[model samples]
Target: MLSVSGDVSASTNFTLAQIQALPANTQTVSFGSGTGQQTHVYTGASVWTLLNQVGIATNPAVKNDVLGKYVVATGSDNYRAVFPMGELSPDFGNRGNQVVYAETLNGTSAALTSTDGPLRVTAPGDIKGGRYVSNLAKLEVHTATSTATATGGGVTTQFQLSGAIAHPATYDLAALQALPAVTRTIGANTYTGVSLWDLINASGIQTSATVKNDLLGFYLVATGSDGYRTVISLGELSPDFGNQPDIVAYSMNGAPLPGTGFARLVIPNDGKAGGYVSNLVALEVVSAPR
Candidate 1:
C-alpha cells in the first residue's frame, strides 16, 4: 500500500492509491493526461517487483540509490510525467514505498475511460501533474548509468552539471545572431545565429573537473513542466557543420522561456538523436581517451 498526492488545477485535487491488482511483481500500468483533471489508476503488476519478491538478487545496492533515477508514468491521452527516484522509495522500510501496481484509489476500485482509464501511477510526494500521468498506459523503470550494477560496482567517475537557469525575460535572438560561428553540429538542425557556448559558460552552474578532464562523451536530457522529455547526444550538443544541428530551444515567439523546473542535459559532441531519454539522464564521461 502506497500513498499518492497531486493537483490538476487550482480547484481540482487528487490523492489516490499508487498501485493496482495482478500480483506483487507481475503487473503493468500506463499513465497520461487528458481533458479536465488528470487521473491516475493502476492496471497490473510489473516484473520489476516480481524480481524483488523472488529475491532474485535485485540491484540491492543500486535499489537503495533510487534517488538518482527517474520514473516515467504514461496515460492514455498521450500525456505523461516524470518523477524523481527519491520520491518513490520508502524511508523506514527495507525498500522505498515505490510500488508499481495497485488495486484502488481514494478507497474506491480504480477505473479508467476506454481511451484513458484502467490504469495510472500515483507518486505520493510528487507535486507535478506531469509526473502523475492518467489514462494508465505504461510503466517504465530505467537505470541512468551503464555501469549501474545492482551491487557496489555501479558507480562511475563522471562530471555532473547541476544548476538552474534564470528563465530569461526574453531570448536575445539578435544577440544570438551576432555571436560567432560554432565548430560543429549534432543532429539535423542548424543554430547558425547563436553562441551556445556562451550560454553554457554564463550559466552559474558548477562544472565539475571531470567535464574538462575527458572528452569521452556527453548527453543531455531535457524535461518539460509536463512529463515531456527530449535527449541530446554528445554530437548533437556540439554538431558538425553538415546535417547535424546543435540544440537551441526557443520560447514561444521569443517570449522568455519558462524556467526548466527540472535540469536538462547539454553535451557538445557525439552524433545521436535527442528526445525522451528514458534511462541516462545527462552527460557522463565514462572514460578519458588515452
Candidate 2:
C-alpha cells in the first residue's frame, strides 16, 4: 500500500489495485542503469493527479501560495526523493512525473518484479534514474514559509544569496552584470541575465560530490521584496537533468528592469506567471527534510 499525508485535506492509503484504477498514464523513458543506458515504457497515474485527489492546502490570501509547497516520496527501503510543487503543477513546471506500477518492454507487458516493486516513482524529464524511487511507501506534502505582503515600494538594488553554500555572498545589480550573460526571448520581450545554474555554482553547493544523489533532494527558494516566495527543485534547473533555462534577469528589452527591480527571477517555461518573482531580494538553498 502507498500512504499519503502532510498538509493535505485528506490522508489515505491506496492499494496497488486502487492506484492502477486512477486514469492510467503511459510514458516512454530512458535513463542510466548499472549495466548501461536503458529505456522502457511505464504505466501509472500522474503525481499531480494524485496530489489533487488528496487536495493540497493553500492560502487563498497569499499570492501563488502553492508555489511554495513540495512533496517528499519515500520508498519502503528508506530511499527518498522530493518534487517541488512548482515542478509538478500544470501551471508551472508541468514535468508530468508518474507513480508507476507496471512496465512494458519490447511490446511485452511485464509486471514490475518484486525487487523493483508493485509501486514505483518515475520522473520522465530527469536524465538520471536516481529519482525513480522503487517500492514506493509514502507521499508527504509540505509547505514552506509564506508571509507575502504588498510590494515594499521602489526598485531593489541588491539581494542576498545565501544558504547551504561554501560562500554566502551579497550581489548587487553591477555584480550580476559582471558575470557571464545569458539571453532569452519570451514572447515579445527579450531578457538578459545570468543563468540560475551558474549563479548557484558560483556560491558552491555544499553537498559532497562523492555522495551519490546528495544534491538531488536540494531546492532553492526565491523571495521578492514583498515576501513572495517560490520553491524550485535543484534538479529542475541543473543542466545535466531537467535543464530548464531559468534565469535572474536584470535587463528586459535591453533596458534595466524599470519599476520591477534591479533583478527578477524568470521561469521561461511556466504556463502561468506565478513563479516569476519580481523585485527579487533573496535566494536560499535548502535540502528536503528526511
Candidate 3:
C-alpha cells in the first residue's frame, strides 16, 4: 500500500492496481547505479498530477503559495527523497517525476523485482539514481514555514547565506555584484545576478564524500523580507541533475530593482511569481533527514 498525507484537502492510500489506473505516461531515462550507468523505460502517473488530484491546499491570498511547499517520498525501507513543489509543477520546473509500477529494464519487460518494489519513484532528469526511490510507500507534503517577520522598511540591501556548510557568511549588495554574473530572461524581462548554485558552492555544502549521491538529499530555503519562505531541492539546481538556471537577481532590464530590493530570487521558468522571492533576506541550506 502507498499512503499519501500532509497538507492535502484529503489524505488517501492506494493499491498497485489503483496507481496504474491513473493517467499513465511513459519515459525512457538513464542514471548511475552501483554497477555503473543503467537505462530503463517506465510508465506511471506524474507526482504533480497526483497532488492535484488530492487537492494541494494553498493560500489564495499569498501569491503562488504552492511554490513554498515540498513533497517527501518515502520508501518501505524508510529511505526518503524530497521534491520541491516548484520543481514538480507543470507551470514551473515541469519535471516529470513519477510513481511507477511498470518498467522495461535493459529492453526487457523485467518490470520490478519482488525485492526491489511493487512501486517506485523515478526522477528522469537526475544524472544519478539517488532520488529514484524504490519500494515507495508514502508521500508527505509540507510548507517550508518561516518564523522571520517582515519589518516595515526600505528595500533590502543585503542577504545572509548560512546553513549546513563549511563557510557561513553574509553578503551585502556590493559583495553580491562582485560574484560572476549570470543573466536569465523571463518573458520580456532580463535579470542579471549570481547563480544560486554558485552561492551555495562558495559556502561549501557539508557532506560526506563516502556517501554516494549524498548531495541529492539536501535542499535550501529562501526567505524574503516579508517572511515568506520557499523550498528548492539541491538536486534541482545542480548541473549534475535538474540543471535549472535560477539566479539571485540584483537588476532587471539593466536597471536596479528599486521596488523589489537590491536582490531577489528569479526562477526563470516559473509560471507564477511566488517562488520569485523579493527583498531577499536569507538563504538557509539544509540536509533532509535520512
Winner by lDDT: 2
Q: Which pairs clash inside model 3?
A: none
Ranking by lDDT: 2, 3, 1
What are the models' TM-scores?
Answer: 0.32, 0.93, 0.88
lDDT for each residue of candidate 2 in 121-167, tens digit (9 for 90 to 100): 88776776878889999999998643234357557888888888889
Predict model 1's lDDT versus the native. 0.32
Total backbone collisions for each predicted model: 54, 0, 0
Measured over all alpha carbons after superposition, the RMSD of each candidate to the real structure, in angstroms, is: 17.8, 2.1, 2.5
Off by over 4 Å in 2: 145-153, 208-211
Query: Model 2 TM-score?
Result: 0.93
> After superposing candidate 1, which stretches have Cα over 4 Å from the reference?
1-68, 92-110, 146-290
Pick by TM-score: 2 or 3, better one: 2
The global C-alpha lDDT for each of the candidates, from Candidate 1 onward, is 0.32, 0.85, 0.83
lDDT of 3 by residue, 37-147 (tens): 988888888998888878998999987788778888888877778899888888777878998888776666545776567888888767778788889999888876543
